[model samples]
Target: MNSNRPGVLILSHCGFSFLEDLKEQLQRRQLRCFVLTSLPLAEHVPARLEQIQVWADRLYTADSHQLKLEDVNNALQTLHKSGEQVTCCISVWEGYRHLMAAANAALGTYDIDAQQALALRNKLNVRNQLADAGLSQARAHALTAPVLQTLQAQSARYFIKPIHGIASYAAFPLREDTTWKALETLRLASVEDTVYASAFNDGLQFMAEDYIAGQEFSFETLLIDGQAHVVAIHEKYEVTETADTVLEDSCTTPPASLDQAQIAAGLQWLEKVLTCMALRWGCYHIEARFTGQHWDLIEINPRVGGSLISHSVEAVTHGHSMLSLWLDLLLASQDDHAPRDALAQQLNAFQWQADGISAQSVATFFRVYFAQPGTLSSVALNELPLAPTVKHILLKAGDVIPAHAREVFLGQLLWAFDRSRQAEELERLAHLSATALDIRYEPGTP
Candidate 1:
């Protein structure tokens, strides 16, 4: 491999399903792709390891599941010494953002700094930043005995969540009877006994924030030079709150509940929030709530939204997934001003339409199915007169669904329909949720 050739470094903790598409796109631009993953190859499934081997020009694996900063720095140093000049670094995994940022800093690439990445990962820090700027109506307190006592005294409803969390783990409504001991027990069980333990980079800390009531939506946005460009807006039509976590099962894009005017207003408010937080560049999956009067912050994810969000966005944008666009943005950031400006213009003028369909007439919806903790026997979707456009199965027969797993997804389905059929389609989705998906555990198993 020529050291002079441009290269992109990807840091991953566990995800690899997107490698094929990402590799094809990168190869088109004549760039070499390198991957550094915390997941040891010996423990990885053969199918996924094959995906990585097919994608990376070079693959480096850490000794453990959790990556250390020193190990990441050493890998970059080795690449540089070998004449592989990595110009950009990226990761879709939230747990590795700081590592990505650090790598970019060392390589003189474009990305937020390590400090900013750390700040963004902490829910408490984000809440305080929004509160200081008056962008949030909710007040958050660290989960301590004193803070719990204070919340009790206020006699107001609040939500408890991990300060550094993924997949809505350890998130629940804070009740009057909720105690510090109960929270600790849940945190230990959820964090220590699960596969995502490494994601909680910031130790076992939690927070309780004032709960805001309204319709929940997420803005899939891109920022260039401090300006926000919304690529898609998804309305969470169905959210289930469990005893320990929150599961968002279904979503529809172009927000079936909000009109064009309201969507425009949301975009404006989102720009302000991003500006206040000083989040200047990259893809952002920002979750927020809309009261009848105004919008409040839920949380801001500095990566592509998970599940089928990237796929749905790609469908609406006529072939641009959040990951693809983010890659383009990173490559463009290293180029001269002319190319960067051109990309900025294109992102700003994007519309949600595909195959010549008008933006208002096209809607993409997806539903996720989850399984309980047990030895899985089988999983399948009953034959439907009309099937979804895409189907993804995450588990197979004989796989054990861990009791402490944050969100054990069985499969996911996505469909595209005309906006006029939104009502009818949603009803069908509800029916599928109740009966279409069949997940069975082993006999006599809970």
Candidate 2:
């Protein structure tokens, strides 16, 4: 609340579980951190809520589940009335990007423009925009009742997903036999009254796009004033399709599947794709498929990749996490051109080496597990043949799993390996981890 200190406003949905780590990093740089969230206080775990209250300089909770521009503006007005100066606004949540943009606009700060933020939320809009520019190979259409019949008659397989969705909710493959009734039923059962409902802020419109078949990968990129820098590339080792959504189970860095020549070509293609989309600044988790000769667009997420992606990137990139670098970028945006240019040059020169471990010799891999919809009785790791560097248990006993059929994480395990043995070690460890881990549910619950 000191008027002389520069403040940062963070817009969040649900809850930011990693506030302590973020606060510590910001505090070291003499930045005051304030949180404005749309998650109702009653929904928070008592212990987690206490940690949030203790870490943030100021906390504002909205009565509603979804944050809007009016809510952000009101909070800004209150801060101004108190003689506080908020220099920048940021959010890692994909659904609240537009609200973050709005807040920055009101404060005369730096962020993606409001129109571009809104355009990124719609899947069909993104596909059409990129396809028109020859950046994407997929063709997409809005899923309406009249168009359902036409889509069914087509021979090409389609991927059905919400226009504005997160956590892979309500995403599945559409076969020739797929029916509109089944899609509607799944939409209601998965989205309505579920924890993921707030993510569909732009309504429940769905789209069907031609399914691009190839090996899946994600590029973690950082943009500095319209220039793209590739931080790391992750190859999805295992991708499982559930009844309603696709689950990315395991990932490895430096993509074991692609050669250096392909990697270089993919980076060139990605630069063009980002430029065509008009994404000038911010962190992007761009997902795509590589069909041997070329790459196809899957989706572009305007935030850090979720579920230990930041951790893996930090391990390989000299302890520089995406969140930390992103904060540095935002803070630098407020400075004059000389300082900004210097920081950008430093970021651009980042190399993948840390603590004597070269990126060419080291590899990081992580595996995520999901549980079925039911009442959780227990989740435990009985034994570990290969010790992981980091392990996180997300759900505990007596936790009731929602029936939304989304990716309900049970736990995650991350490990570091020598690049020479990465493939063999990953397979062996994955198999062992699966057998040693135990997850049980309450009887007669589904």
Over the stretch 29-116, how does candidate 2's per-residue lDDT look in tens digits?
Answer: 8888888877644556565556678878777877676788888998889888877889888888787888888887788767788778
Give the deviation of candidate 1 from the true structure as CA RMSD: 3.1
Model 2 TM-score? Answer: 0.92
Clashing pairs in 2: none
Q: Give the least accurate 10-residue stretch of model 1, judged by summed lDDT.
A: 351-360
Provide C-alpha RMSD values for all models, in order: 3.1, 3.0
> Residue by residue across 226-316, what tens digits does model 1's lDDT show?
8677788899988988887889989998787776667767777787898888888888899999887788999999888998898888777
lDDT of each: 0.79, 0.78
